[model samples]
Target: MADELVFSVEGPTATAARQISLAEAGFTERAHLQEWIIQNPQVLGEGVLIVTFEFDRWRNATGTAERDRLDVLGIDRNGTLVVAELKRGAAPDTVEMQAIKYAAMASRFSVQLLAEAHSSYLSRSGASVSADQALELLRTHTGYTVDNATFRRPRIVLVAESYPPIVTATAVWLGEMGVPVNLVRVQAYELVGTAEPTRLVSVSQLYPVPEVESFMVGPRSRGDSEQDVGPELPEIEWSESDYAKLRALPPKPTVQAILDLCSASPDTAIGLRVIEAAAGRTVFGARGELAGLTMLVKGRFKRRNWPFSVEWGATNGVNQAHYRMSAEQAERWISSAGNLEESPTSRLRSQEINDFGSPVSPAPHKESGVTPQ
Candidate 1:
């Protein structure tokens, strides 16, 4: 067995209490350690997003009797595939090479393939989730868009009790050469007590040091080749008549309450005051103390009762609440606004609205402010 980790108890006088050996604790078995990691992937460290453990089996390209299985597969925040190879005892000399082969095969995996694998893993674990749902969950958690560009390359991670010097040197060289590879050492310890379970684990990253690790795993290293795409500006201008209609529409208490909250801060409210940029356009814009902190509200009213729709734009430096709702609903809620409940409409984001931009049948009358009889 390797050097065993010991636990000491300290009181008036300190004394060595219990010592844990991976071999004696049965953690030296690959299956046992694998199971523990599958249960608690966070032990791998922060920013490690494990999508599935014991990922689907893959046959060797040579078509022989040989086959290979990846112990764990995941993606970091930047969407680079992470192939984690685990060992219970000493890491084999061929572990890094085996991981490279796995990474090569996994690099071909498209976002759809990853989502399907994740869905299957979820099903096996008794948690129900569709491939689309799994993909959305992955995006929500990692903040990385799942697409071809994002999943083009892969990184490698080796986890074991100890790694040979050769493997450590190779990992460092690969990392410096722009290949994102890391080594993590995980050791098991035992606690002296009458408790039902008396084992503890410690995980530490050991290769490439800490300073270089960040740069190697950062966004630039994820192989993202495309430039950042900004939000598309609206082509149609707001008419002056449109602004008048919006101003005449009755205010909903729900919206007014939000306005009131903004009003409480005079400086902020003044900075965010409504701007009438174009005829028939009324935009309530405000900037918070924080840079890029902004709120914008745009509405288009019809001659009928309420405005046709009101768009409560993104708020709080986050694009969470971009939604459009019918004028009548706003009026009804505002007139009798009480305890507010989350409406399904409020969950709409900008993408959902953009999806509704397809051409539609034209109304009978083309004249402005004209209603069909």
Candidate 2:
């Protein structure tokens, strides 16, 4: 694989930093890589909860320990168990088969078993989360029951610097055969004149390129497979109970501002700069952090299926992703989250949200020139 480049900007000058191997950079699979993923699991998927790492609780029919430890195990917003295998460098050829075995073993876990493991993991991390509490946390974060028929199988995610051709081929074949597999590349780069530690770690999805597949016309029926993504997901309706849950959350000033801005124009997608200006600060984190916000909200009592949808497009030659809230949810969110009356959001009411590349609407957008993030 060709080495990737990371540039450092000093004033108007840009310096390209050479990409180094994991060993050269003093990183190991278990210590550095696994810990980063556990701390921030959005690298794999939005709203994925870390159940446990180095998991080897599986037992054979004879009650013998299987003695196999998966690197990291998590669950996404849809309650599908995520089996993520980590590698600091390029993955060996046998990695795919190894991940498949770990996934198969994890698929046998029930809601009870999964909660117990999560609780244990939490305790080890000095967080002391009980099994019952863990189960409730799972329900609130995912908004889907783990015991449902949909979570019968676990999904697979491979994280490495690079992968062999055979491994990528197997991943594609598995996806075609209805297996949910994601291949991610985690890059490590050292920048010049940054801080005490000038290292920069970036995670990106290699397979199933999302930026290319902006929209897909597909079936709407809910399927058992996690890979069955419909053309467009319906806006999640928030109930009184859901509103109460939102109110229970700690003061999220940024989220509150977003609700007010989107609620102002109802059914219109707003620019990130306008949202940021409304909030009076840079609200969302990097791409992974932004995914946790727009795609799925995750934290203590984080709400799943947030009514926000982010669409990527070009603005003045720069590509930016914008967030939108439907009219129904906009009204619901503002009322539930407390009323905040601001200036009307400057947005065009587009007829075609699916065809984002086309001109937004007949009406001009006052906020379009606000410079999206």
Compute the lDDT for candidate 2.
Answer: 0.66
User: Residue 310 of candidate 1: its Cα lDDT?
Assistant: 23
What would you estimate as the lDDT of candidate 1? 0.52
Superposed Cα deviation of residue 50, candidate 2 (Å): 0.9
Q: All candidates' TM-scores? A: 0.54, 0.59
Residue range 1-373, candidate 1, lDDT tens digits? 5344455456664433354457767775457777777777765555567777766444343433324677888776546678889887789988899898778767766665676778788888898777655654554444323445556567788988888988988898888888888798877666665466577777777875756554553345455423322222222333444433333456433333333322222222111112111111222121111101111221121111221222223233222222132343344343333355543333333232232221111122121221111
Candidate 2 lDDT trough over 10 residues, lowest sum: 364-373
The list of candidate 1 runs beyond 4 A from truth reads: 1-20, 28-30, 59-66, 192-197, 212-373
Task: Tell me how far the alpha carbon of residue 55 in candidate 1 is from the true structure, in angstroms, after superposition.
Answer: 2.3
Residue lDDT tens for model 2, 161-207: 99999999999999989998999998878776666757777788999
Q: Would you list the clashing residue pairs of candidate 2? A: none
Alpha carbon lDDT of each predicted model: 0.52, 0.66
